[model samples]
Each structure stands twice: as structure tokens, then as C-alpha cells.
Target: MFRPENAQSLVGLALTLLVCWLLSENRRAFPWRLTLGAVAVQVGLVLLLFGTPGAQTVVSGVNDAVDGLAAATARGTQFVFGYMGGGDQPYQVTNAGALFVFAFQVLPLILVISALSALLWHWKILKWITQGFGLLFQRTMGLGGASALAVAVNIFLGMIESPIVIRAYLDKLTRSELFLMIVVGLATVAGSTMVAYATILKAVLPNAAAHVLVASIVSAPAGVLLARIVVPEKPGQGGYYADYGSLLKYDSAIDAISKGTMDGLTVVLNISAILIVFVAFVAIGNSLLSIFPPVLGQPVTIERILGAVFSPLAWTLGIDWKEAHEAGYLLGVKLMLTEFIAFIQLGAVPEGAMSERTRMIMTYALCGFANIGSVGITVSGMGVLMPDRRTEIIGMVWKALVAGFLATCMTASIVGAMPRELFGY
Candidate 1:
């Protein structure tokens, strides 16, 4: 089994950091302490959660709750769509295999989790957790209070929704702080979406829920650390803002849940539409590629092209060379499309296509929301919240995407370096 103390893992860690450093906008001013601290924190948390029996039990409990939520979603879908939606039926049929109908089985959990998150936010439970995390970032990373709070909130809320928490300070934020927010937002998946992903990945990875939760938690600080390197803060420019007040509010518990459900419906519909369109596009692209001369008795396609291009990067993240191309293909899919699409494809991967260790690394690597489509969404959503900074946000979009990509890869490399025995592999 792989161990963290090995030379190969150390080389992987060094190469990961080196790539981030080489991409730094201001190498001289890069925040080494923040980067090192973020790595230490991530490794520490992973060991505590994966190596310790007590923490593993807690993670298992959370996974159980996720399973329960998934089951409840099935019940709701079954009630509406009958047997096609996973309900009991008198005779066997292929209706359950329909893409449109299958979406109902998994996507409804987004509604439930989103509504539950809103209710918790309204009750200030999420606020307390956000504040606690914010303070840690403020103290450790030297981030302003508003920036730290926004980054922390990104763990639970969507990228666009998180900025609303620090709305008042958006314009006043320093360049580095603003970019950090964007990078963190792109780097981490929202909690509601995380549950949906966990459900999708449950078959191949039994501990998918725990891994998704840990990936989000680690990526926040890691994103900030990487963002600072890419766009280092100017001296005497960043400080905690104590006056940013709460922007999320509700009339009552019912109101919170109602609005959350409506918002989730929008997300669900958006995802369904995107999947339909993107999948069709990929198929069309592959058809065009099929006209090319065969390679190894198979027609060249987008996946193979992506694999050839990004396989080296995947190998640097500690994926085995033999499986690096497959992992790279998934990574490319994530960058070109969305993590949701990439994960759905991952779920469909044939057994023996990649080793279990490589799958775990890919899971963490592709956990972010950084993709070409997300750039437009971030710009439009953040534009609505802070119109004055729309131009700046647009300019920073590509850079933020790169930073977010590196951050997720950084997390994956760190996880890959950890001893496999710790995960009982």
C-alpha cells in the first residue's frame, strides 16, 4: 500500500506545489506560509477522519444520513412517476432505464438538501459553523473577515450564493481578496450538490459520501492558499471586515424551505438541460472524430484526445501511469463541461478501467465546480450582486478557473500521498 512518507509521494507533493508556484502572478510575494499551512491542515484532517476509528464512525453516520435522504427522494419520485421512477411495479419494464426518468431518482435529493440547508441557515446553525471557519482562515491565512466568511460559506452554498453573504464588501475588497472568493467558489462544490454527487458515486465507491464531504472541507482553505499565490495581496491592503451583516433571511421556516425548493428546482432543471445538450454534443463530436484513421483498432475520439493531452498532468498527481490517461480524460471532461457530467461518466466507467486508488484520486481531483460553463454563470451571477465589479470579475474568470483547477488537484495529490493502509485499502 502507498504511504505518505515515501519518496514517490513526496515528489508528487513537491511537483504539485512547484506547478502552482510557477503559475504565480507575483512569485516574490507568494504566500508560502498559507500554502504550507493549508497542506498541513488538509493532511491532518484526512488522517483524523480516515485513520481514526472514532472519526470514521462519525463519517459513516453522515453517509447513512445521505443514504436516507437518497431513499426518501426515491419514495417521492416513485409516488409521482410510478414504476419508472423506482416505485414498485406489477411487471418488469425498461422505463426505469430511461434517462429522463432516471434523473428524477437522483436529482430530487438536491431539492431536499437545498431546502434543509436553507432552514439550517435561517436557524443560524450554518452561520455559526461559517463564522468558526472564517475565524480560522482570518487568523491563519491573514484573510479579511468578509473574504474568509465568503470562502467558508462557499462550502455550503453555491459560488454565486456565497458572494451574497459578503455583498456589502464586494466592491471594497482588494484584488487578491476578490480573486480568492472567485477561486474558492469555483474550487469547492456546494453541500446540496455534494449530496447528489455522493448518491451518483455510491455504487463504485462505498465511502463516496465521506470523501465528498472531506473534499469540500479541504478545498476551501486550499483554494485560498492557491489564489493568493496566483494573485498575491498587495501590502497593507487586506484586513478583516467586522461590519458585513447577514444577507440571507426568511419570513419563517416554511418560507425558507419554500424558497430553497424553488431555487433547487431551477438547479435541477438547469442540470437536466445541460446534461442533455452536452451529452448530445459529445456524441456529435465523437461521430466527426470517427472519420479519422483508426488507432489501435479504435476510432479516435474526444476522450482519447483529452487523455493524450492531460495524461502527464494526471501522472503528476500520483495516478499510476497505466491509468493516468483514463483519469486525465475525466479531468478534461470536468474542465470542459462540469463536474456533474464528469462524475456521471465516471459512474459509468467499466470495472478494471482504472484502479480503485486512481478512482479515489480522480474523485477528489474532479470535485470542484471549475469549468468553461461555470465562468459565464459566475460572471453573470456575481455581476447581479456587484455590478461595479462585473468587468473585473469577467477579466478574472479564466485565471480563477485555473486557480480552482490547481487547488482541486492539490487536494488530490495530498490525498494520494496519504498511506493507503489508512483508508483500509
Candidate 2:
């Protein structure tokens, strides 16, 4: 028998594609070949990732490695920051939850992972993987050399950093290709943040490392699929820049470590500031909203407003109508704020408030960096890379954000389509 959630997800998938086409700049120019190719690639990848035995073993090993890395980070943090950072407590803990400090414990993983990512780039480990995927995308999806490379690299890098890998082709990329890069970049999380995200979700979701990794990898094609639909390429409009491999490099391992650590420090500081400022603003907004009368027996807070607006979108992702309002609130927070904030809030939700399956679906849906603030970050980053195309960048970015956001939803719907048996539920 066909599962009810799977049926819902299939419908959600169709609705997602329909919505993408409805917003297309040139619907007649839709690249059906790329569409089919991207979907096939995504399906094959997801199956290979979830169904294959050997792949599962590898994923398990990866999870173990991530745990090791997290442990190593804890060691480093404890030494630097004392017992507050997971070191031995000078006094007996009254409560386990009360003793855990997010800033001291979890945020430090960003520093360790960033430095390791830089070291891997220096060793060409990341470059080789990016090349293999880039070639696959270029051949299967008919993407330009630069677009293929950028999207593949984006699986492991940030929105702006991926473009840096294809810096040589930034100016030459067609408008469609440029937009695709941004969408894919926003659709996936960076490698540096993957472990940190896994750490956050590990308590709530088993095998969180693999889920985040698969979400980033699988969402690449979903981003491409939606981006192409929303802004289909016209023949003879842009040059075909094929893959030339990664141009990103560091002078040496030591240089990589230093640069990576500094980069991590920037992210750490930014996350701190963002959480502090955004949380306060949200509290202020909620306080202001309190003046209004309650609606439908609930206070009209920002989250409730967002939940009402996005509940339909959440429902379309195979979420139950009854639970969708809660899921919608999370999605709204993700789009309006950031995924970091979303994940934190998700971790805080009570156990029985949402099902384990719903949590998994939400995990994939909220994996990306697409949000209101990221538009400015992306445009400014892309603008710095290609100053002359700033106008085009500005024009296409908001649309790309929409595509990016929907791409993650598309990924979630596909995941929801699968039997819960595959996930050991």
C-alpha cells in the first residue's frame, strides 16, 4: 500500500514544481533536458545515500569521525575555557541541562571545523570531491563549466565562498548561471557549519551528521532544478564556461590553519551578535504584538503570525494539517531569521509536540541559509566578486532566495515520500 505521507509528499513535489514554473521569467524557455537530468541525478543520489549498504557503512564511518571531531573540539575548548567548556567541573553539577553552555561548548566546533575544512582544502581533498561532482553536473545537467563547479563546491562551502572557487568565471557567467550559483549556495549549508548543526540536532535526531550531510549534497540538484525553472537559460544568451577545477587555494597548511581559524572567529562572533540582537528584537516585537487582542484563542505574536502564513507551505511538505502550524512557525522563523535560530528553537520544542518523522522532514527543509538577511549578504558578496554585474545581481537575488527556500522544501518532500522504514523509524 502506498503510504499516506508519501502520497502527500508526491503531491507536494508536484505543487513545488508547479509553483516554480508559475514564477518563471521565461516559461517557454524551460530546459526540460536539465530538468529530467537534475531529477534523475537527485533520485539516484538519494537512493545511493539511503538504500545502498556500502554507502550506509561509509556514512556510519563519517558519523563516527564527526563524533571524534566534536570530542576533539571539546578537548580544545575545555583547555582554553575551563570547566564551562565541557571540562571537569570544579563542583558537582546540580542539573545536567543547567550546566551545558551553548556558547562555550557548541560554538567552538565552528572554529575546529573551519580550520579542518581549510586544511582539507590545502590538501586538495575537498577540491577533488568538488571536481568529481562538478563533472557529473556539467555532463548530466548541461550546466556551464562555471555554474557546475560553483554548485558542486557550494555543497561544502558558503554562499559567497563557493563563487570564490570559480572566481575566474564570475564575470563571464550568464545571468541564469549567476542566479543558479546564488540559489545553490543558499540552498545548502557549508561544511564548517555541518558538524555544529549535527551537534545541535544530535539530541533530537539520531544520525544527525549524516542527515545534514545528505541534505546539503542532495539539495544541490534541487536548487539547480528550481533555479533553472524560475530563470530558464536562453540559447546564445551566455557563454558556456566548462569546468576548470577549483581555483580556491591557500599558500600552505599553516596558512590554511591561520586563515581558517580567523574565518571561524568571524563566524563565531557574528553568530553571537546575531543571536543576541535578533533574540532581543524578537522579544521586543512579541511585546509590541501583545497589545493586540488574542486571535483564535492564541496571542498574535510574531511566531503565530508567521505560522499562519506558512502553515500551508508546511502542510505541502507532507506535514500533518494538525501539526503544520508548529512546523510552519519553525519554517517562518528559518526564512525570516536564520537556520541557526531555527535549529535551536527546534531543539527546544517538547518531545511529543512533533513526531520524529516530522522532525526529520523539518530537518531537511530548514537546512539551507536562505532568509531575508542572506539576500543582502549574497548580493554584497557576489557584487564584490563581479562589481559590474551588481544591478543584475540585485535584480535576480530575491528570486533566487525564493528558489533556494523552495529547493530545501523540495528536498524535504522527497525525503518524506520515502517509507519511514528506510530511516529505521
Candidate 3:
């Protein structure tokens, strides 16, 4: 079932690693053991997650839960904002698609999921899970206690939020360890935003929530692998640090909900604000470019420009050249702008613009916090906690950004190279 064409993605995989090595501070020393282990771990995750029938069922359950959560979030929105919030419309419906309002309906899911995650954290469900992953990283990948914990936490939390859990360990980490933590953070998406993204692309990509989870988990080792290559630990640098396991504390269940909702609200506002600004910029930029002649029979808008620029890279993800333009645009938007906007555009991609397989690959590739904007966000967030290392953090962000970008790229290629039957597309 492995198409010969998929081999191109393997080339992509090799090239991605090579680029990381090329950018290495210590080119003479590559962590070959760590690199091989990392790739195997990603393949293992894809197999365990998608190759089994039981795991397929789990994927279904997760999708169902996301639908239910979206429904629940809708109820809250309707109660507060009336029909505009996806409640009954007073006017005769000419177009149902018009009724699917993103601001009113989709974005609100963040608030609910955020609160639930907080509640789970208070209950120690998430904590136990994080610790389990930390143990796995420490054992399998040779990560330090705090570094492993930070990487594990990033699977479920945001860049800054994950680092906050191991705040005490931030200053204590070696250069290589700290950079790994940042790259891992950039390479993964926050659990709080996962549902919102699931809702956005559920129509285009099957079991979208599950794939998002898959992308997040697999990117961990990829991040670790790339981080180590770019900044190899000192020859004698052994990963050891204090146990920062129970650092994310809360007063009670009620306190957790309150804190979580407030945090979600911050995310919600930040998202809303960014969308407005970015969309406006896109509009302005497109308007200015309207005077330019069309290329390939399409207008020279920002989207088309982005697609043209990123097509080759998207091709590396095993997307067909014919479909690469569309995939590239989304990839470009993700790296240059934000994943949220990219998801919105991907959801709106006209049917047949790209194959379902290409869409799935893009979903995996886009499932990260690696973008120009996030580099600054991660730097600032980590800097606030350890202001003394602000300069050092700033210096390493560029390397981490490239590592994070390539980390997600590696995940896509791995998934792309596998037989569709293996994952049951």
C-alpha cells in the first residue's frame, strides 16, 4: 500500500534533519542515537495511534466528545447572546452556510475546554498524565527531569504555560536543555485550543481532533531530536534537575474553574484581537496588490503569493505538486501568520482543491505553535519568569523557531510516507 510517490516524503524527512544539522552550533557532533530514537518514536506513535482498530475507536470517541463539547458551548452562547449565537434565526434562511458564524459559534469552545482542563488539572488527571509522559521522555529520550516535564506539559498546555509549570527549573537548565524546552513548546499546540481547531476542520479532515492529538504527541520527540542536533549538550552534560512535578497548584475545584476561565478568556481575547488585525492586514495588502496582473490565471493576492512561496515546502510533505499550491498557502499562512487563520482557510478550501490525503497531511503539519508571532510570545513568556536570562532566551529563539518549524514538517512527512491503510485515512 505504500505508493512509490510517498518516498518523496522520506527524502523530505532526510532533508529536514540535514537542515537542522546544517544549522547546528556544533556541526562536528551530531546526536545520532537521539536522532534515530526520535524518528522511531514518531513512527511508533503513528503505528500505535492509527494502526490499531481499538485506537480508531478511540479516535471516534474523541471526535464525538468534541462535537458534544461544541454543542455544549453553543448552549452557553445561545443563552447569553440569543439567535446570533447560533440560536434560532428570525429571518427566513436563504443560506445555511451564512448562519455558521465563527466568532459567535466556533471560537466560544475555547472557554469551555479551558475551564474543563483546569478542572481536570485540579483533579490531578492531567497532572498524572503529564507525569507519565515526563517519565517516558526521561527514560526513552534521556531528557532531564525538568526538561522532560516541560516537554510533556507542552503536549497539553501552551508555550508559556508549560514553562510556567517548571518555572523553578528555568534558570537551572543548561543552554541545550532550555533551548529544547522552547523548541518543544513551539512544535506543539495547546490542548485548550485543540477543540476549537477540531471544530474548524472537522468537515474537511476526518477524526481531526485525533490527528491533532497525534501531531502534538509525535512532535515531542521530533522537537527533542532537532533541539539536540542544533544545540548539542556539552559532552558531559547529563540531564538532571529537581522534581518539579506538582508545581501547577490550585486552591480548590472552584478556584481552578475560576482561574481556568480567566486564562481561557485571555486566550479568547488574544485570538479575537489577532484575527481582526491580521485579517485587516490581509485585506489591505490584497487591495494594494489588485493592480498587479494575475499569475497562473489567479489574482495576485496575499494568499496566492503565500501559496506560490511555500509550495515546494508543502510538496516535501507528500502533497502532489498540483495540490501543493493550496497546501503551501496554508503552510505559509501557518508559519507567517497564525495556525488559527490557516485552519479557517483550510476549512473553507473548495472541495477538490486538494485531495483528502493532502488535507490530512497539512493538518498534521499545521498542528504546532511554530510561527513568527509565537517566537516572540514564547520568548516573552519565558523571559518574564527569568528576566536575567532574557538576552540568552532572545538569542536562542531564532534557532528554536527553525527547529520548531522543521519539527512539525518532520511529523507531516512521517505520517505522509506511511500507507493510508495503516492509518485507515
Give Cα-based local distance difference scores for all models: 0.84, 0.87, 0.88
Rank order (by TM-score, best first): 3, 2, 1
Ranking by lDDT: 3, 2, 1
Task: Please state the error at residue 254 of candidate 2 in Å.
Answer: 0.5
- TM-scores of the models, in the order given: 0.95, 0.97, 0.97
Whole-model alpha-carbon lDDT for candidate 2? 0.87
The positional error of residue 149 in candidate 2, measured at the CA in angstroms, is 0.6
Tens digit per residue, CA lDDT, model 2, 1-425 = 35888888877788878988998998887777877787788778877877788877867887898899999998899899998887888998889888789999889999988899899989989888888888888888877777888888899878888888888777778778888998998899888888888888888887788888988898999999999899888777654565454377899999999999999998899888888888888999999999999998988899999899999989889899998999999999999999999999888887788888898899999999999878989988888889999999899888899999999999998888888877767
| Per-residue accuracy of model 3 over 72-139 as CA lDDT, tens digit each | 99999999988889898988998888888788888788888888999998899999998898888888
Give the lDDT of residue 231 in candidate 3. 92
Per-residue lDDT over 1-425 for candidate 1, one digit per residue giving the tens place of the 0 to 100 score:
55533335456567656776787778898677887788887888788788876987978897999999888888888888886677776776665445335477778889899999999989888878888888887877778888988988999987988888787777788888899999999999988899988988888886889998889888888899888888889989978585534567888999999998998888899889989898899999999998899999888999999899988878877787888888889999999988999998887787667677778888899999999999999999999988888888898889899889878988888888887767666
Error of 1 at 11 (Å): 4.2
User: Candidate 1: deviation at residue 253, Å?
Assistant: 0.4
Runs in model 1 deviating more than 4 A are: 1-12, 93-101, 243-245
Model 1 TM-score relative to the real fold: 0.95
